[model samples]
Target: MIVVGVDGLRPGVLAVEWAAREAVVRAVPLRLVNVVPAWCLHDGPTGAVADIGAWMRNGGKSALAEAAAAARRVVGTVAVETSLLGGDPRRELIEVSEDADLLVVGDSGMGALRGLLVGSVALGVAGHAHCDVVVVRASAAGPRPEVVVGVDGSAAQTAVLDFAFREAAVRDAELRAVTAWNWRDPLGGPEASERALAEALAGRREIFPDVRVRTEVVEGSPVDVLRHAAAQAGLLVVGSRGRGVLAGMVLGSVSQALLHVAPCPLVVVRGR
Candidate 1:
């Protein structure tokens, strides 16, 4: 099943949008997770604590019902479920992700209590989730019809590219494969970038020729370039840096940028 974390009263509209779409594509059910405070778990479920627990559950049910209603608006007829857990949203969401096929959350300018669902909580889940995670930053400029993916000449990218192509095919949208062009090196300029991107796309054509692919070589940091491309696309795909860290070249930086500032849904693939 596809799972999404909602902020309850405030909610994350873009997250619901992605969860609905992804559930439709995967032919799976959608699960919404709402995490409240941990006061009752520590204080025990008795007396005044029991009253508070009921209140928390009521609020959680209300919030989850709102999120489920919003999801229904998108996919029309799909199975949607919800769970209300106590404790920190960040830790609780990581646990919720254990059984999820894809985890979807919102980008809520985290760092404060009000933004718990999308901020630090969302980022932590995306970075550490065993399953694939999608962070949604609502698109303000109407509907974007295409999907953009950042592809560098790095290991495991073929797997990530395959993930992007599959989503593009599911959306029946145009796929743009973007790479940061290095102009300082004369040997690996635009021509080099073109070749690398072509090689990356080579064998995949036979598998997903129906996916209209557009390759680009932009002269800038991968984070900046991919952000620009994602601003106009419906979704942005990138591979996690795994363990290593690279400044502007690796997706570690790109993922950081897009996780907070992207205009569309961002998918960070952890595996092929």
Candidate 2:
């Protein structure tokens, strides 16, 4: 199933709509989830506190209802399910990711303030989720028929290629695999990057022969290269960590940076 977190916010509704369309393409069920903060509920049995808790629960249910309706509007015959959860939003969503094929959330969560590029919940879950996590953002140019992916000869390269190809095939979009070459690195030049990109995607073409692919090796920062390439793409897919990132880090610096600036929805695939 595709699980999407909805808070009734504009970005949250966009996430639901994206997930609904993805469900239809993948032929899976869509699950809309709204999580009430634990702080809203009280341990004591005070009447006022009880009333406030009830109000919060009701609000969460209403949000779920609206999310379900929005999903149905996107695809009326989609199998959609709604859930009202109570706990830490990040933890709850991460747990939900275990059973989900894809877990999606809005780039900005509720209580978003000016200058806050990405929401804490979205970042938290993206870094810790057990499965792939997609952070949805509205693109200025609207949806395009292309999926861009970052390719580095890292241990996670295979998984990243698999995801990029699958997504391209499902969306019937072009797959653009990009590799960034650092000029300072003598051993790994543009030529090396190109070879790595080709080798990483060697057999994926056969698996997804229908997906039109274009590969490039540009010399620059990984984040900057990918951000420009995905300016008009429908989706941007990358591994949780890149070759340059330390293994101890749950989220690579490049992936984290792109999450804040990528033009389209970004999917962080966990390395298996």
Candidate 3:
């Protein structure tokens, strides 16, 4: 498991919480990574042209230290590792994701405008990482007991279902599997949409017998339905294609809308 490390704002601490939660669940070590611009090596603390990258390296180390401490507090001192990636932050994170079991990131800010604008690094990594990605936002007032996932019947559907079921099992929470379509005469009718949702989750039940799943087929936009369902959820899981033009985009919306609207943590599964 891996978590993004940064200096300030909610992500650093939030990432630690989420990554630590998974670490506890999977009994795995957590790795914290901070990506720095390679050019930072030229920046000097004395305002000089360059500091041989010492400043950047030290900064990364400090962030990793804070993140590690937070994770220990959250998961009662679990095994943790740290690393620093040079060059483009987004590219480096994507590379780190290739070997990580899961990747967690924080939204740049909490303001509506800020949240809506997914950081370029987060956007890039979410779309390209080989592992699953979870983006944390808004603090919770209390514990939420449900995990919601979207089913689009795309190639990514299986991975999304598996991820949702596994997470629900891990959290001992109810899984709400949702599918939405534009309301119309037939193609968008509730019956057909409900059947599609059932088909999409067909064999997944056998695979995850312990997970209790409730299916929902609503006549509305996919993102809107998902946003509504996630109102009381602890996590919202969605699927995205990590390759080509759709890279990092969640449900054709680029992850901006939900990241801004959903009051819970958002997990964007990189689909096969």
Best by lDDT: 2
State each model's CA lDDT, in order.
0.77, 0.86, 0.72
* Backbone atom clashes (below 3 Å) for every candidate: 1, 0, 2
Off by over 4 Å in 1: 9-11, 41-53, 109-118, 184-187, 242-251
Model 3 lDDT on a 0 to 1 scale: 0.72
lDDT for each residue of candidate 3 in 106-170, tens digit (9 for 90 to 100): 76621113434555556666667778888776456126789998887667777888899999998
Model 3, C-alpha of 142: deviation from truth (Å)? 6.5
TM-score of each candidate? 0.87, 0.94, 0.85
TM-score of 1: 0.87
Give lDDT tens digits, candidate 1, residues 71-115.
899888879998887888878887878888888887772223563
**lDDT tens digits, residue span 1-272, model 2:** 99998888888888999899999999999988888867665466568877888888889999999999999999998999998887978888888888999999988865456678888888898899988989897544236889999987777888988999999998899999998888775447888878877888888888898999999999888899999999888889999988868757989998899879989889999943
Local lDDT at 86 for model 2: 77
Models ranked on lDDT: 2, 1, 3
Model 1 CA lDDT for position 103: 86
Better candidate by TM-score, 2 or 3: 2
Those runs of model 3 whose alpha carbons end farther than 4 Å from true positions after fitting are 3-5, 41-47, 51-54, 109-116, 184-186, 241-251, 254-256
What is the TM-score of candidate 2?
0.94
Question: Who wins the TM-score comparison?
Answer: 2
RMSD of 3: 3.7
Give the Å shift of residue 246 in candidate 1.
Answer: 5.9
